[model samples]
Target chain A: MTTPALEAKGISKRWPRTGAVLADCSLRVERRTVHALIGASGSGKSTLLRCLGLLEPPDAGSILVDGALAVDQGVVAADRSVRRSVGMVFQEPSLFAHLSALANVSLAPHRVLGLDPESARNRACSALDRVHALHLADRRPDELSGGERQRVAIARALAMEPSVLLCDEPTSALDPLLTREVMAVLRELALDAGTTMVVVTHDLDFVAAAADSVDFLHAGRIRISGTADLLGTRGLDDELDRFLQRS
Target chain B: MPRVLAPLLVLLATMAAAADDGMARLRASGIMRWGCDISGGAPFAFPDPSDPDRVIGFEVEIAEELAHRLGVRAERFSADWLALIDALEADRCDLLINGFEVTADRERVVAFSTPYFRYAQQLVVRAEDRDRFTSLADLAGRPIAVLNGSASIESLRSAGVPPSLIVEYDDSLAPFTETILGRVDACLQESFIAQFFAGHDPRLALVDAAFDPGIYAVVVRQGDDDLLASVNAALASMRADGTLGRILQRWGLWSDAQRELGIDRGPIIATIPEAIGTPPEDGLPWSLVLWSLARAAAMTALLTIVSMPIATFVGLLLAIAILHGPKPLSRFCHGYVLLTRGTPLLVQIFLLYYSLPALGAWLGIPELLTWNKVVVGIVCLAANYAAYEAEIHRAALQAIPQSQWDAARALGFTRAQTLRFIIVPQSWRLSLPAIINDLNSLIKDSSLVSMIGVQELLAVALGIGKASFAVPSMLVAAAAFYLVLSLLADWFGQSLERRARTVGTLPEPIHR
Candidate 1:
């Protein structure tokens, strides 16, 4: 009867230009689990992940983080709890270009966590080591290779010591080999380090290998919700069977 | 007026009256501040070459004696010669007293004291041609340089010199300088100037043909009868006791024409002090000339340094408000940039330095807008450049990609934190070249403050060029100064860029 690690119910978002992009979407992710929100482009999967991360507010829904109310019915408090508990990795390869990779990783810990310079740097080094990006600490983002940048980005999220990591297509900009490399790092973080993550992507092989549970978001709602074994059992739904055929 | 504000209005009225009555202000301050254009070279208010701070000229002595008679020491206020009269009308000085002639037209705006010295137009030509062009009539067809606003042009025209053949120079020794350079055939100017500015030169000689007699006098604001009467009495006493003769005789300006003012004078003799550096004939020593230029350059540099930081800060605030402030404030800042950019910096200098005080008076805020010249110079410069700097900064701030802002916010950063750490530093790199370009031109424009009587590099060149008659040399030296400072600014900008370069890339060395 332990509460789910993160939960959302009846989440809806309306954009001024494109109305009702997400409508009454719901999901539940258990602790230390790799949950993937998968859909084609414009399916509102990213919008739902953004809502879970508090990057955006849903027009109507409640989000609970580890059985605690982080947002209710679009009424968000001045809540540092959500910010402190969740770390976000965006689809864009975003880094502070003026700083070195190490400095970029260390900045939030020192500023947000109020760590001293030496302690923040140590935390960043250990996080980078965990993702096997320790050697790229001195390079600026422009100097790092594509796969190396994604590894360092994962390390940046890890440096925050978050209970949940919300990633929006972190491998969308990478090639197949680089995408395999980044998904391997994510799988290792989930299995070995017990870091919970909700990844939003449409990579089928990645879902087959890394996801413990999957939500098939179609037309802004969770149309298929089950364990990753559902991808192997595709005859149940015609749309799901066709999605597997294309991949 | 309401009873509560009655005391405040009376206080303001008293202040307005005190500011207006130049004589009372002089007496109250115990310093009779007199206005003169220092470029009125030798025996008129030119700076002493040995020590330019110790202004030594016949007019300087006359002003001192007049101030002593009025029970106050004289303090000299120098402005551009063309602006000295406006300076007087603005109450920047108690009276104007730099060789003002007693002309009927001048009498309409300002009252004149009795003539202090007498002069007539004289012809000056190359020493080798002095015999060939001894009179104005002999110079009819050749190029003749005459003081632009003086009686010389009328006299030259009346004596049958062709109008096309006449070259007009504004009231400085530039006419005679053209004769020295062999650019003109002859110069027709007053005798006193001809003697000091060109007669001292071994290459030039003054013809004995003196015509179009005029008399120099002190000028006071028209309704300043008390100060006018005091100045006239000082002149009369100086003449009666021979102090005026001694002063004029020292500069070789004593003339037989003084008998008309009731003074029997002694023989005229030239006696430029030996300690006052060398004469104009030797030209100013290069070391002394450069030293004056160095001081002037320092003023220009100091003005740039002091005002630029303020300008950049003001520009940054303006840029931020335009980008991030509420809609009305953003629009207002954008409009401010447009308004400031549309106007000339020269007009801004005059409006702030001159018209602001006048406006303040009309608004019944006595002395509210009055600032010292240097302060006014800084204010005007800082404000004018702020408009351009704001535009540069706005572009720079916008150039930092939104991805970086999203990254910082996702890392739990507040808006201010993101701007301080992530946005501004990167934007500064994008905007560096444009900001430095603004800075380079601002160094050059610092010289424009001289229009407000700021004695920076170019003003020094004007003063020394006129006094030494080495016009070309002094001017070239001043130009070299501005070029050096602009190069230094370029260097500073590049060094900062190199320090902040992206980690692994090497920036190319600047090619000359």
Candidate 2:
């Protein structure tokens, strides 16, 4: 099989105050595919996503991106290259309040990637256009609506053209109507641009509709993992079934 | 025609003043600036107990009588006694009339008026230690205090006392206090000062024999022959008419010095006349004061501008070091902030300008470290404020959410890059108002540097007050300059903050 775009093996994290938020969780995402991690509150879905995104250093794990070791035995390797390849969209739409959406998108390309300002700006414009957020490019974070700000944030990450994109509950703050709009754009990017994506969510319906693959996490471990089509046909295990029924 | 006439008239008046004698200018101005020291307290120039603002003393009366004779108002200009002669030479005052004793050494730099009073130096010791220090010779090996820059210091050295044994104080009271407190074995003073201080408290008494009889004279600048001659004529007339003796008698200061000079026998004045009155009606010439203030403001601007960038840069480094540097460096930065912010700016300036030179001397590199007062002021102000600025920068940096750092790091930016491009710019925006406030305060605090003799705006105005005895006007003018500069700084800071928030920012203006 072609090499997976991103892989995390036996990820475990223990917080100083709260022990064992994530434990021995492993995930594999194929190129151009949309994968979803779904769990109840207090589960380690977000923690696993963060570890895969390299936002948090796992207590124990090896992460590989594009068949190259990004983290080996819980020690980060090729950190800068790993971070450059993996992009993150925070749940709260972490846009720099001082910068316009376009500058926010262009900043990393111009400054971090050493692209010329014109080229960076052009790339920023295209990224925004790709996310259907072109109209909001010039707006500051405060000036944009909740959904528009989230889209701009996504565009900022896309501008970097990462090999894998990780988002944590990006649509959690949005109403159902805006959630649908954002998910539609995200689906288009995954299908048309062949952009690999990992999303952490609490919504089973969202996973059922948009996710190509699904992993059910509970109490810091993955209980079941499969193609979404298979899960939908064969149904969930007892624990996941109870979780789905309750939520 | 009117404008031409006005310029021509002003030119004529300026030339006339330049051509005339110093005495003529003094008479024309109708205000004689009398320089003296008031920190020494009573019997020379001390605050009048009845009206705290007005100073009263024998010298004050003498000046008033002299000004009355010269047909002008007598205005008191007080500085330290050590600075009195310098004040006279700088034209900050017309004359130094404060118990200034004429000696061969002093006569080289200044011309003294004819003798108005003559007094011998009296050695005073604590009552308990009086017998042990019976005379100057007996106190030879002991630590004896004398007024700094006084003739007493010179006389004590000549009287076979070791130079190191003679501690000099700028204020007159410190020597006597030190003696009574047993910190010093003896203190030398003019006979009259020794009498006044020792007479009040039984704990103190005079050593038996007086020494170094010297004549008190009003000192004028060396080339001020015309004013000197006029002052002599005034003194001679006061002597002939017994005005000097009567004034002295009222202050209970009539002594054999007057009898020896043949001016002691005069009508006894029963009551001490009220020498000081309400402040003079003539307000300071605002236009002239403003002109002088504007010139001084240039130095103030130089101090502020030159120091600010240095302070900010140092503060930035310190803040970063505290936050991210190695452990030792972070601790050092923390210590720096603690020490600088914990102390007074006045003490810091004194350390930088005064103690630093002493330190340099100890280090055998005094020449390199001995900077001019202005340079020292800048260095000190910058260093002192940098501690504050570092705190400001640290606060601003901390105020930025941790997510911002995460965002920058996740974007493949190095840590320094994240700080330099992303964090610092945003922190600066939040810190601008506080920084501007500090800068404004610094401009005002620049006045404290005057203690080390940097004649910045306020110092220059004060110098003018010394020369013309126009304190109110000079202060008002200096305050106005500071106010204007602060307002300008505020405006500039606001503009920068606005630019930081809006400039080159996107969300290109929208078309429907």
Candidate 3:
């Protein structure tokens, strides 16, 4: 029905000496759903997320968006139309230092979307408001708190109006209060915008609170996939259980 | 009316009495300070090679002879002809014995002794050009270079030579060399000096005809008749005893004119109808100073304006190529820097100006650019500074962070775009101050162009000094001009630096 919003079929990646970080991994995210990818530190969850986000090209298999092949048979198209449809939030705050938070959010839209300066600025302001970060729109990244910075980053990503939003441990650097605030914002954005979301994280509390579905990744392969309700009760292997306890 | 006349008469009488008192004061002092040129140019005094402090020349010998005859110990100081009048006016010296010419202009400020030698302006050309130009008429429309302040320029100008054809030089040697190098058709000098210079260099030969016959005389402070009479008496006695002849012979300056005119024998002639014009007090020629500055300004501006852009562009490219090119290419750029920086600019100029044309010919490149000595000098200066500017730009580029590059790449910009939009703009601020300093130095260094006969400011001043024998004054003026230029350059550089920092507070984007 409307074809899964994003699908990665047997995606795999290997480094020269490090061998495989993602091995024949497959993931499918339906429209208006949040999928939490959970695994240990050395697992292939982040690599899979990178592949799904189209930030990294997979060595094998294909990525499909709305039933159409976006990355086909290990070939990423020269034109980055897929990237424009997908927005990514990095683990570290890689915001451009020269621009204000508002400018940071507005840059890509004005540059790639051909939005005039006034429209781009207005869109950037609304994006900041969505994250409850409108007041800090004029502030530089250095002037913002860690939570405020993460919120601004999310606003920057949301301003692109992408179909799929990818988060790489977005809340990993935040404290408890800040983490809750950021997760709440992500949940609100997912539900209200009807956007497909994929998050690579080890935070079970976040998964329980926001994810509609979950996948357990181990040693570059997906060990299990199911509804989030089954996360703590069943279907977990001994290694995953141990990994979860350690986290 | 009677009272006014009485005061006027009294004032005149008082001035006369003061002059007498001043003379009495000088005689009582028993020390007659004589100023003379100390650079060895035959008749002019120069330091003895064995003892650098002790001077010897025809003028020095004459000065000592005059002082001995005056029954006073002569204390000598090196003096330039231009400053000799100033020195006497300031009481720094009681007499000037550095081949003083008896110009009427000089008589306004100082009195003169009977002329010791009959000096005539003569034309000099390369030995090969000797047959081409027999007299002044031969060089009427042709370019003829002459030392500034020399009687030759005046004679040549008066003889209907156009101002544009007369290339004035500050240093006589350069003007002479210019003729030898075929840059100028001819040069003019005093007959004795021309003969002396021509004898030393086989490439040059003197013409037989004289342009202007001026007399060389000893000068004393104006109203110092007693000092002038004493100097005249000593000169006459030296002529009688054949001492002047012996001095001239030692300098290889003994001539038939000295013998025929009885300049070496007694009865010294105080005046001669042959003396073309009144002697110049201070005998300082302003033309030489003006010509020197004009040439220096043109050359320095040419060197700075033309070479600076080339140097900056080439230097920046070199720095970037060295910093980012493949290993082999970078190594070559580094080697170039080492080679250029290791040598002196003067040596570089000489090689480029003198040797490169030959090399170009051997390489079979059409000599489209051959023998334009000024171009050679400019290229040499540009090449030399290019090495330095490259280093400066390299350091500035390296100071930028690699993070900038990575950020730009992450933003989907290509490598070339990143460099153009990001790296270069940032490096501009850092490289500007040093570039300005290099420019200032480049302007000053342009004076070296004179060696290639570019006829710049210092060269012009030197020519004037040589011609008028006013070396000290010309040097001072040249120094002042350079000082003013340097200050202006420095101010402009500072303003540019300030403008570069206007965007200082803006965060620089990272471009990989």
Candidate 4:
């Protein structure tokens, strides 16, 4: 009842080339929780996440962040503070090739938030230390391995101190071992910092291991919502049953 | 050095004579071949602008009359103005009869006829300051422009004008033009050239007194006395019969000095048109020559250094405009890239230095009226290369993956900050090699500005070469300067590409 931290009402998006990617989908996330959206490749999970992150606007919907109208009727809020409250990480760790990881993490705070360089750098160091990537601060993106780069990217987002973090397949580019390393960092952020995150991931086992709640998205809508107990309880929905078995 | 060069002249003359047919073979051929450059200017040998195919001048009439008297038809042969002597030596023509000045060194190299016409130098000033700058002495602190290698320079120096205050033009009309524009205080040139080029221009006026009198004569190959004798007899008869006077009057070149050309003479004191300070043909010290070349090279370098930063900055703006500016500006930038990159740099420079002033005058912009040739050169070089730089930058910007843009924007960065922080730094790396390539090319392209009288490396070196007939050495020295500058640019460029490279950027592990 504390405004659910972030909420979307009836989000719909239709692309000209591929029509009806997301249709009238609604989602709600609470503070201090990790929520996972799991779907097949073509199921519009990333599109929904993009809309929630305000990376792109939905055709019809209103998004509320911290009880404020961040987006309404497909028109995104023009205020930087609205966008600043939500941070995003891409599937591939597209770090700035020319900057050290430390500079990369500090750039948004210094430039967009109008913080001075010294303060931004201090924030960056703390964020990197929180993600256990302090040793990789001086390295360029190319110098870091898959796991370290993902951790640095997470640090970059955390340095901005967003209210809600949206990640699309954050571990899709990593092997199983590196995926576990990145997963541990995300678990630590949720446990120690109480940071809220909405993640769209193909890795269902990661959801079972770490996600506090799960939304089963299919055919452009969230068809079912449950906890980990629902994944083991079969025969509730055949589509979701087949999806869990395939995983 | 003249002591050594005099016999060397004789040796070259001997080789020339061995290739010649002599006067007897010329009479059998029944055509009197005459060489002249038809492009210098009027009242001399030049193409009639109204009918360019008809080459007409006082010298053309003389060639006709002299050929008629020798019972042969006159046929025109083409040669460069400075290379007429070599042309005659190589048998490209039978006689050299342009506005050929009778110089002392030339007198050693070939034979000169009696003075058929005496020409003197006229000092021109802006009409408003006609009285203030009457003589070379009056131009002590003020800049004076003249045709490079003209005898006017000798007389000006004799009258105690410093060489630093003298500006030499590569062509004839720029002198009067510069004077009228107030870029120079005055210009000095032969009376005929001043009259032909500036007679109708109300902005310019010639001084009442003509000084530094020199003569025009016909030059023949050495040891060809039969041909020389025929030429001399024909000129003497033309002078006596008043035909030479009529030709001069027609060209508006006749003056009282012609009466002293003397009656029916073989030689009237083999004239000395040489200035006292003429660089001795073989006596130039290497250090002096190299020092002058270095100064000129510095100008070239300054032009490159000043213009390149402007080009790169403008190029970045243009690239951004094309890539991310609003629709109309993007279209405009696209057109700009096409228009600038499609044109030649020389033609672009010519338009900026030459045509722009005319346009400026029409638009009533006073500043354009006096654009220093160097300033125009800098602007033109920057603009011309900015097009290329824009393309380099655009490609580099595009080469950055779309994910980079999304990542920055997701961090709440506006478009400009994304470009400044993430995009441009990486684009610079991709553009470095190409930008350095353009920087080195800009150094050489700076020479085209000399076409408008910049007095840069090639211009200054060419002026001295054109005078001393030592073009090869001067060119080699200039080339060495350019080569050294290019190497410095290369080292600077390579070092820039190496820096800001966080890792072991100098070298890395060799692939097995």
Candidate 5:
């Protein structure tokens, strides 16, 4: 009965330099859901996720956060307010290399929310603890390992307390053990806090094992979508199935 | 026709208004501003040894007396000795009481008051060579030093000395110093200058005869007859009261030439004033020399420090504007950089400090920005270095990775925030070494400001060298000071760079 936690309708984008295009793609994630948008490289899934996070505005699209219009067609609904409601974790850790892990995680709340430093730092600490990265909080990104950096990055997003989180390949650079650990942390955040997450990845195995819902993106559109169980039985559209199998 | 005639009449009225009000202005203000160049040193107008800030010379004493007789407070305006006429014409000062030798070329530009001192050019040679070069013809093949634009040039030519064999110097004392250093065989300079600058040294001796006697006088702007009359009357009274002779006597400058000119016809001074600093020793006094140069070194350091921040700030804004501003504004910044960097710094200083005021006067604009020598030096130095700094910043900014901007913006930072937090810090770190190198160059380039009349370290050292004829040693001391100042700047810059590398954190020093 509740509206999906995040929704995109009719998203499209184009690169003027090379004439690449993403046409008419849409996706929805339910409250507390672990949704994976799966596609091969160059399928435009990462671009769509970035557009949903408002990092790059889509040429055309409407994005909704908790059924409220956060972006209408080409215009962003609000700048900091809309961005505050939706958080994103990049494919790489993308931590501010100049900052300590704690400062990196606390920067947005301190800068955007005008939270006093102490409270912002405390909130950052709690977010790090959520991802079990408390030990790495004082270290710089250069000092942290691949998995620790990702975890700190996740903490950076979680500290913002957004309604929806979009992550692009959050486990792409990790080993299998660290991948499982990061997945487990994400699953726990979804289950405990009822936070919705939409992850873009080519990891079909990750989708099959961890996603509550799945969308198969090909070319520029979501070619197939269903609950994981249904998608597991039905398979993706034929071409994408083969593509996913190869990836 | 009437419209044209009306404008012509207005123009004539304005010219009439501009006519000489010199004496009236002096009376109204109650201050007789004397234009002078204290860097001329010693017998003319030089820094007092006991208090270097208080200038003292024979001319300084004469100006005080003249101002007293005229019932006004005396004020001294320091100008480049070479540019004193320009200062007088600019109405920046009323009289030039510096050792202005009367010459027809100068009289064509400004009126000369009655002769205050008269002297013939004296030939000076090293003590050992005093017997070798007795007459001008004896110096036929050897190098002889003469002041540039002095009456001695005509005397040397008339003496049958080949023009190519004579070395001319623009500075007042360079000829004498060059002679003492044996860079020239002999020097022909005014007799009074010989007494003060070269006569003190044991190695130099003045030949008994003097040549081409000339008078020194107060210079007033042409057409300022009212001011000229008052200055002449003051000179007559000083001559009557023996004040003029006493001042010349104190500086050890009273000579036969003054009596021959019929001005100082008073009794000859038998004893030199005890206050005259013991005649500069045979060579430079290194201890006192270093002490004097240290003050100049401090001034150079202060100039560098004050102007560099301005250069850095201006360079930063210029770089940002060139890189990020709209098309027209960016183009303007590019043009500005090209113009400032393309021109010689000396030319820029001259244009800004000298030519610009002339241009302002021609344009009839009031309150045009004319600054003192030091300020003009700083402004020109900052502006010149700013162009280089801007280019450094631009290259550094461009070198910043795009990923940094993406990361900052992805965190919801505005464009300005992203630039301030992510881009500028990295760019500045990348550019610090280059900027510091430029700063070292700027410190050396600061000496060029002296040409515009800033009495910075090198200028001060040159003055001492001129006074003592110890150019080589004084120049060596100046070189050491500049070397140390540059080294200090380098060390400071490296320390800053180390701190910047740690991203604003002060790291603990490493110990073995």
Candidate 6:
């Protein structure tokens, strides 16, 4: 319903020397739903999320945000203003080292959205509060713990007020305790803000706890999709089971 | 057996006497080395303007002529005026023809031929200030510039002129220019030198009163009795045959005063005096050493003050341009570095001093003034070194983790903001040592200012050496000056580096 907040149809990517990282991958998320993409390493799960987020355009695909096509037939349209409605968190904690968490979160809104400093900062503060990171908003990335930095990163992405959020292995670098804390913050933001999210990760616990729906990616293709409870009960298909076992 | 012993003894005595005679030894060797001054005091002895290796002057001509009369070819070597006596004493040269003034002190260590020419110690002033003095007394309590160890200084001193009144210089020409600039009341120098300089500059004129007569003679090492006798014999022959007059006329030293006063045709008069207080004035070298130290210190301070901001600003821009500017702009900056580093610093200075005027003309900019030339020289020096500095900065920037850039970008910062806030400060620490080294080099290289006529330390020491004939003292002073300043620069550089390390360790990101 609600025109599926975000959709990707037949997305494929071929990197030179690393052919077909993603092939014929498709994903769709309902309004305000958290969709988890779980796979082994090199399964193209992160690649698919990047394509859907418009951070890296898919080699061949159609991406639609709010029922409007943002990219189709290997070309982004001249007026793909839908990028403003999508935000991303990379696999690494790619925070702006030059700026504190608060400034980092506010920069895009001020620059791209043309929001003045006061309004941009107010929105940033709200975003930080949603992720429970408002207390550490002024800290630089170097000064913060791994979980804290990831939370700040999540807040920075959410500050854009994007209709769809993409997270690429967001907690991979954190320890177990920090990883759980970061995932908890992400789940809280998803629930409270009602934000549509496509989380690309290899963590089964994160997928089971946070995701409403699940997709299993294997060798650049989405091999299975279902409600999280059903996917968890049945476990993964044989190919994904083997892939996850090896990982 | 007794007869054989007698014959062997006779042969040995003959060989010993011939070996002890220096003139005979020189003839037997067939190589005669003559010392000449190359410090650009033309007409006496100086390096040929077009060819630095060859020396040309009245002294050169006389040395060559005397050597020809002795049937031995002569080769000239240019040396600092104050070093000439040492060179002679050390057997580095057979004779010195560096317009060496015949003074009582020098006679103790070196033998001299009869004086060939008499020069008056005349005061030179701006034409505007020609009437500024009527006598030496008029300069009392005022700065009267003189070459460090010249007859003028002695004349002024013996005339009871106070030390406070004399401002000794290392260069022959600077005192006159300094007077014109009103830095000094007047400059006392040889009449020939004063005339030569005043001839080219309409702004300056020679004062009419003669303060002292500078009698110049050819000098040979002491105990070279044979060489001294041969030289005196040649001088006597020249005087008898009018050859000396022809030589003086050829050099334009046949002054009207010589003719009007009938001094040239008079009987050969010897004013040769007993060797006096010191063998050559030792004060010239001492003053030189002091002047050099002062110059080195001043230059180090000036370069540090001027280049720090320049290197910081230019180095930052260059790093940014290479890292983030348009591809073509980055390539252009790289080319600039390659070109500057490929050439010599001396060539760069020459280009700035001489070629810049033409460039200015082509660009329709105003002609560069003397002061402008100095500024340009400094700028050129800084720019040449800035390329190296930029490379240092570039490396430092590269040394920073790539995560830093990603983090900044993720924070929604544009490339410019990320670089300004995150990259530059870290790079500053990495580049500190190299920048300090470049600063030291800049201080030492500032000595090149002498070529373009800026009277920095070395130039001042040279002036003093020429005047005082106390070359060793002045050089010692200059060396001492340079050493102290270099040490100070090292201390400052080390301290700054330590501070940079401490600041670098602070865990904050560049931006708040």
Point to the candidate with the largest TM-score.
1
Query: What is the full ranking by TM-score, best candidate first?
Result: 1, 5, 2, 4, 6, 3
| TM per candidate, chain B | 0.83, 0.59, 0.50, 0.51, 0.84, 0.51
Q: Write model 5 residue lDDT over B134-199, tens digit each, in one string.
A: 877787788889876667878888788889987888676777668867899899888777776666
Q: Compare the candidates by DockQ and give the number of the best one.
A: 1
- Candidate 1, residues A19-108: lDDT per residue as tens digits? 888989888888888899887778898889888888788899989888888889887645775666778888876877877788888888
Task: Write one digit per residue (lDDT tens) for candidate 6, span B317-336.
Answer: 88778877899999998888
* Candidate 5 collision pairs: none
Instruction: DockQ each candidate and list the results.
Output: 0.33, 0.23, 0.05, 0.21, 0.21, 0.10
TM-score of each: 0.84, 0.67, 0.53, 0.66, 0.83, 0.59
Task: Single out the weakest 10-residue window by summed lDDT for candidate 4 chain B.
Answer: B503-512
lDDT of 3 by residue, A123-150 (tens): 9889999999999877777788888888
**After superposition, which runs of candidate 4 have C-alpha atoms over 4 Å from their true positions?**
B1-270, B273-284, B503-512
Per-residue alpha-carbon lDDT of model 1 for B24-56, expressed as tens digits?
A: 767889999888877656657876665554567
Off by over 4 Å in 1: A1-6, A9-20, A56-81, A219-221, B1-20, B40-43, B49-54, B89-91, B101-114, B118-171, B175-191, B194-215, B221-225, B255-283, B355-370, B502-512
List, residue by residue over A100-128, the lDDT tens digit for candidate 2. Answer: 88888998998878888888889999999
Candidate 1 - CAPRI tier?
Answer: acceptable
Off by over 4 Å in 3: A1-6, A17-19, A44-76, A99-163, A170-188, A202-204, B1-302, B305-407, B422-512
The sequence of per-residue lDDT tens digits that candidate 4 reaches over residues B321-386 is: 999999999999999999999988866765554344444434556344537768888999999889
* Per-model CA lDDT versus the true structure: 0.78, 0.77, 0.69, 0.78, 0.77, 0.69
What fraction of the correct interface contacts does each predicted structure contain? 0.44, 0.44, 0.02, 0.52, 0.16, 0.16
What is candidate 2's lDDT per residue for B1-512, written digit by digit as tens? 11222233223223322233669879889999888866555577765433333567888889999999988899887654555564454345688898888888778767889888888899888888767778777775789888776789888878778788989875566687788778888899888777766655678888887888888889987767788898999888998888899888877778776777657548866646332222224544556556656867878988999998788889988999999889999999999999999988876765455444444545556567667768988999999999999999999989989988877777788888878877887888888889989999888888877665555787666555432334456678778889899999999898878787883532222121
Question: After superposition, which runs of candidate 2 have C-alpha atoms over 4 Å from their true positions?
Answer: A230-236, B1-285, B361-364, B505-512
Q: What is the DockQ of candidate 5?
A: 0.21
TM-score of chain A of each: 0.96, 0.95, 0.95, 0.97, 0.92, 0.93
